[model samples]
Every structure is written in C-alpha cells, then in structure tokens.
Target: MSTLNPYCPDCGAAVAHPHAEGCGVARCLFTGGRRLSCGSRHRADLELDHACGGDEWTGRWPGEAEAAEFGWWTCWDGPGPEQGWDYQGQGWVQVPEGTPGAVPDLDRLSTDAQWDRHALRWVRRVNR
Candidate 1:
C-alpha cells in the first residue's frame, strides 16, 4: 500500500513514497493550537479547507537518511490513524467527535474535561 507523489517536494528516492494517501488525514483536521489554528498532520499537501499549513512532518522532506531511519509514514497506519495526534478529537483541548454529547465548538470552548482519561486528552467543553 506504499505510495508517492512525484510532484511533491523531495518525493524522490522513494523514502517509502510519501503522500497520495491523504484523504483520511484531511477528514480529521485538528485545530487545537494556541489560537485555534488549522493543523492537520497529513503526510501530503491535500490543500484542505481547514488546513492551517502546519503539517510539516508529513508535507516536508525529512531527508533521505532520516526518512528511512524512522519510517515516518508507518507511524500513521492503524484502525484509528488519528488517535494519538490532533485528529478525531484527540489533542490539547480536543473533543472526540464521536463522544456522546460531545460538542466541538472552538468559539464556545468554555469548559475543559478529560472525558477519556485512558486516552489522556482534554476536550473543550461546549454547551455543558
């Protein structure tokens, strides 16, 4: 399932082929930065609407040596790929979108709650 975009920056030497599988990451855009900025950690430059252009880890080149050393793309393959990062309601002040009674309104984050201590993420409380 490895892929790559020849047009992407430094998308050469394989580096395990970065990008071209950038749909899921686009759907789970995260906005938990200091100023509620758009921050999606997708490996490709999908040019999403909510993308605040801060996904350097995926969109940029980590150099040929570093890319092979860490196998970066392998880090995001899972049932819940966006579980650990700032997606799927996972991150600082992020509320899991599927959580029962979970409302994610950046403008109305008046409360903060650790709904899932096991996951160790504090979601912003809206309308609670």
Candidate 2:
C-alpha cells in the first residue's frame, strides 16, 4: 500500500516534513479520517517486528516481515526510503487543502501575535 502526504493540523497545509518550520497552526486530524464519511481510508502498519534491527537506527527494513495492517502508525521522520508508512500517510489519507474546516487564508496570520492559548485563537502581539 502507498502512503499519503502529511498536512498541517490547523490550517490543512501540506507539511513538507515533521516539525516543519513556521507551523504554529497545525493540529492532529487523523482521527477524523477513519470515518466512512471521510472515505474510510486505511494504511499498513509495522509491528516493530524486532527483526528489523535494534533501535540503534541501522536504517533498514524488518528483514522478512512484509506489509501488514497490524496497527496504526505515522512517520515522525522525513519520508522513509520506501516504507509502508511515512509522516504523510501514517494511517490515514491526506485530506485536500479545502477540507471545510481548514483555514482558507493563512496570510491573515501575522505571527506577530501569539495564539491565545486560553481562547484557542490567535491574537496580535502589541509591543510594550
């Protein structure tokens, strides 16, 4: 199975990499993807089969283990060479830019202000 692209959780912008720079707006939306209304998309999962080598980060596959829908997963790392899952298509398909709830105009955000964590909104930061 092929993986999908990663997107910003807040504004729905496609994030080139995990922890991509300047994304104060993303929130995780993978949970919504599991619904039938959201296309009932499915992805393969790696069971940390152990044979894949140790956590030493040798950077290789799990030898004999093939792709299986064992569980949910997503790459926090950049796109893997050719793994079943990457940061993008972890366990759900990437919803397009205009997914209803997505922020249509990122420009409105100046980044001059901070997200008012209390109200869950962004407010302009005025200099003292």
Candidate 3:
C-alpha cells in the first residue's frame, strides 16, 4: 500500500499530515491557497482555494489565444536557457513566435543556424 501526503496544489508544496483531514485545506507556500493536495502522482483529485478572496489566477501559456488578446507576449520560442528554446535534437531550431493564432513569417530563415539566430533576435525584440 501507498501512503498519501498532503501538499499545495498550486505550488506542489508539502502540507502537514494533521491538517489533511476534514475539508483538506492546506496553505500553499507559494500561492497561499487554503486548499491543497498531496505530492503524489497517483492522487490527482485536489482543490485549491485562494485565501485572497478573488478569482483564481489561471496562468496562461505561450502562444495562447487569450494571452494574445490581452496584448501579452506569452509565446516565446527562442534559443535561451530560461525561455526553454535550447537545442533539443536538430540543434537550435526556430519555433513559431507570437500567439498561436497569429501568422508567422515562414520565409524568415532557411537553415538551422539562420532559424536559431532569427528566433533569438525575434524573442529579444518581442520581450523588450
């Protein structure tokens, strides 16, 4: 058998076992949610309520349509360490920039080096 431990659903922080009963409310160290979950991969049924008394902040991903509507550059495809654009297999390759729905200039680069260089340039331009 496996033992279930409670953890913050938002940040994945561990929660005290004593506070795991009843409503199963656990404060998140990061997001500070009143409800949390266990740090178990098998346990996916968890709910988190923010103590700040407002709508939960649903984080947006890069290239999401919603992010684009808000004029937010959530989409980032570049050759950087923090941007997750580092070389994966075929060396640094250019990924589509801007939001997912937005059209990209397919004629930007021809080779891998060109793609990487252009992608990095584009990311820098948009980020600034």
Candidate 4:
C-alpha cells in the first residue's frame, strides 16, 4: 500500500490544516473543484461564515443551477422530496414528508453507489 502525504504539495500545509490562501490543491466544497480562497467559495453569497460551518452545501448552493442545467440531480444538503429547484417545473417545489423521493436514512446507504444515487435524487430545505 502507498502512504499518503501529510502535507499539501502546493502550500506545504499539514493535512487537516487549512491551506494557505490561493493554494491550488485546495478543494472547493461547493463544486469539489478548486477552492478559490480559504473561505467557502459559493456562488450564492461568495463566501460562507467560515470553512467548517457544516460541510454540507446550503440551499443557497452555487452548483444548483449548473447541476440542473447539466441534469446532475444530486444535492449537497440532501433536499429530499420536501424542497428543491425542479428543473422540469422551473420552480422551487416542496412536498409533504414521506414522499416517494424522500431522502433515505443515512444508515440505510450501505454502498457508494447507493449514497451517490441518494444525493442525486434529493434536494434541500423545507419552507414549512
């Protein structure tokens, strides 16, 4: 087995430590792409409270439009059937709990594919 490097190759920051500003390898939580700053790089507000204010992307997620445009249904915060921006409907939709596409319990997801499918199907938030 290969050992993992504990330091960031671009900024020399230790693993689990925040990367230096503008570090190339820093991963963006919103898109899983490149992090633009030490702060959360979101399209909605541009910056989150901090890097670790709940890793799940909020309903104000930057990727929502792009995901809908590309037909990527997955949501970072697990919208379930209760709330989400429906691409087909072209409006934010909400449903009662226990709806057909309601997010399954986390423990029920036993595989990576299952987890991915769950994320892809759900959305976030409930107005009620």
RMSD of each: 16.2, 21.5, 17.8, 15.1
Question: Which prediction has more favorable TM-score, 3 or 4?
Answer: 4
Kindly list the per-residue Cα lDDT of model 1 for residues 1-128, writing each as its tens digit.
12333334422223233233332221122332321322444435534455332222243222322323222122222235445444454233323344433332322321332222233223534555
Between candidates 1 and 2, the one scoring higher on lDDT is: 1
TM-score of 1: 0.16
TM of each candidate vs. truth: 0.16, 0.19, 0.18, 0.30
Go through the candidates in order and give the clash count of each.
Answer: 0, 6, 3, 4
Whole-model lDDT per candidate:
0.31, 0.29, 0.30, 0.39
**Model 3 vs truth, CA RMSD:** 17.8
Q: Give lDDT tens digits, candidate 2, residues 29-115.
A: 222111112221232342222121111111111110111121112222234555434445433332334343222222323333343
Give the best candidate by TM-score: 4
Which lDDT tens digits does candidate 3 get at residues 37-94? Answer: 4332333453333232222222211112222333333223455575466544343333
Better of 2 and 3 by TM-score: 2
Which numbered prediction scores highest in lDDT against the true structure?
4
Ranking by TM-score: 4, 2, 3, 1
Ranking by lDDT: 4, 1, 3, 2
lDDT of 4 by residue, 1-128 (tens): 11346666677776556667676665455334346543454345544454421122222232333333323232233434544545244232333334444322322122221212224332332341
lDDT of 4 at 68: 38
- Candidate 4 least-lDDT 10 residues: 107-116
Of candidate 3, the 10-residue stretch with the lowest lDDT total is 109-118
Clashing pairs in 1: none
